[model samples]
Target: MTMDGGRALVLGGGGVAGIAWEAGLVAGLAGRGVDLAAADVFVGTSAGSVVGAFLAHGGDLEQAIEIMSARPDGDPAARPPKPDMDLVMTAFALMYDTTLEPREARARIGRMARETPTDGRGAALEEIGRRLPSPKWPDRHLLVTGVDADDGSFVVWDRDGDASLEAAVRASCSVPCVFPTVEIGGRHYMDGGVHSMTNADLVEGASTVVVLEPLAHFTPRDRLERELKTLGDARTVVVGPDQAAIDAFGVDVLSMRLWGPGFRAGLAQAPAVAAQVQEVWAGA
Candidate 1:
């Protein structure tokens, strides 16, 4: 499907620290005089959706950084549970075990996805979503992605859809096992990152697409490559965490301790990609 407008901005999911990184990227881009909020369409999955919402509504960049950068344990408004260490370890084990058949591995992952209690990290997201513009800016189009927990189907919530923006973003950011699956309009929804961390393909007809991905290294290569291939002639620019940035942010997506480093990493990485982004946008 094609985006209504010629340009699209895509955001990829990353956990707590990821928010900081993306915000930093936003700030860095702003400093470079690159304003991404002008994009015609926005596609966001998981943590990406949170930032996308802010951009869609014209929220303050520094304010978003401050809010997302808060340590969950220390934030009075948040009651996030500690990282589910067992789930993390088990997930890694399942991913590395080549002995299991694809079907069996999928089954195990499905089970693991639902077994953990909702750790309450989502409360902040819900709060943020609620505080965003209710009707949203009419000129902008937003697409928030999520996955249906029961049927394992991919879901895309558009700004014009019946679902409230809050519900859509909440479901999109609901990382399986870390946050509870959201039930909206009879469907149980969870993180769309399970399917594609950056659903860039959704805006197939756009003339240009800018993808800001925090977990680019971890995303399946085939999936991202295929999505880019599907974009056909659209000019696509991607900026993601390099090795140094990834090291600074830490690989633990659920951790909240390294937001400062994550933000700094994004700031450091921005200049290298700024020219590419400027060229694409100018050409678009």
Candidate 2:
């Protein structure tokens, strides 16, 4: 992605701080000449709480509480630290549940996507997918899936050509799906060509765009290489696990702290990670 006067829209707000806060940070930086814009896509009551907190407090704790209190029967304990908000809380919570209710989560995501707005800037775009195809198929979903094995097997999905799918995946996976029309830290960073398209469209744009394994679906090593090769006309960066997988594909790769155990940790690390990516892109 080009790093000049771009935006970094974030989506989803149920589990972690959500994309809104990330968008706010980028916007804040952009306002000061950072060249970034951030947004959050809210999917439910929980997500509503996060978006409400950010909108009410401007990322300030005191303001967030004041806004949250306006909601009837709101619980203070549900609130995160001023910096620890994100959309992946639902995913993490689902992980802990013995039921492993992907279907329920899917339904909730559908509802949340429907409740959000389909147009406008920043948080508004999270609502774009009010009616998405079945998540089970690449044709129906925004991202594609691929699987491979070394000593073990894994899945991978790339956010290379389609930004909307990247946004959807970022929202669905609770990772911050940043964009190029946004800015952060006075530097400009963009999600390349994939910033405007959805993950489903992204799958169609690249070779081996999505990877599915026995238990999970995401970007795997071989798939990353294929995507990079397919994206010869543009610069690209792959985030998440399978660093070695990127190497396996002989693709230029930089690691960022966009995934891991929880939202708090990821939130704490995202700014720095984003900065690093920005720096690399600037130099390139």
Enumerate clash totals for all models, in the order shown. 0, 60
| Model 1 bad stretches (over 4 Å) | 70-79, 86-111, 119-139
Which residue pairs in candidate 1 have backbone atoms (N, alpha carbon, C) closer than 3 angstroms, thus clashing?
none
lDDT of 1 by residue, 191-275 (tens): 7776677888999989988998898787556768889998888988988887888888665766656557777878777787788
**TM-score, predicted candidate 1 vs. hidden true structure:** 0.86
User: Candidate 2, 170: how far from true, in Å?
Assistant: 14
**Cα-based lDDT for every prediction:** 0.75, 0.27
| C-alpha-based local distance difference test score of model 1 | 0.75
User: Which candidate has the top score in lDDT?
Assistant: 1
RMSD of each: 3.2, 16.2
Please state the error at residue 20 of candidate 1 in Å. Answer: 1.7
